[model samples]
Target: MTDDTLAEGKAADREKWKEKGVALRAFFYIFGTHVFAGFVWLLFYLGGHAQK
Candidate 1:
């Protein structure tokens, strides 16, 4: 293959991987926030009834 073609292929692959990484990071961030919110709610519920 020509150098230009090879460079284009590499650039495309890099962009693909970068996109995948960004998506994965966003998924993890959303997942973590949901989990943390659940945990906080659980703690609040558990302690809330005890105060009554």
Candidate 2:
């Protein structure tokens, strides 16, 4: 294949990977937020029960 063709293919692959990365990052961000919120809620629940 010509150098130009090879370069284009590489660029396309890079773009595909970038899109996947963005999606994975978004998923992790959302998942992490929920986990953190749950942890905080648990702490509050325990504290409230302990006071009684």
Candidate 3:
């Protein structure tokens, strides 16, 4: 409850929210999954046409 302890807690919270994994982690996670899924679908479509 002291001022020093409160200041430390705020600093920790700031560090947590500012972490890079909070941004780029979500970016790559969704981006890579969607891109891979689209690429697979494209290949499937191309292959299906080639068989015809």
lDDT of the candidates, in the order given: 0.98, 0.98, 0.93
Please, what are the lDDT tens digits per residue for candidate 3 over residues 1-52?
A: 9999999999998998888667988899999999999999999999989955
Clashes of each: 0, 0, 0
Per-residue lDDT tens digits for candidate 2, residues 1-52, read 9999999999999999999999999999999999999999999999989955
Poorly placed runs, candidate 1 (over 4 Å): none
Which ten-residue region of model 2 has the weakest summed lDDT?
43-52
> Order of all candidates by lDDT, from best down to worst?
2, 1, 3
Query: Which of the predicted structures, 1 or 3, would earn the higher TM-score when compared with the native?
Result: 1
Scored by lDDT, model 2 comes in at 0.98
Clashing pairs in 3: none
RMSD of 2: 1.5
Clashes of 3: 0
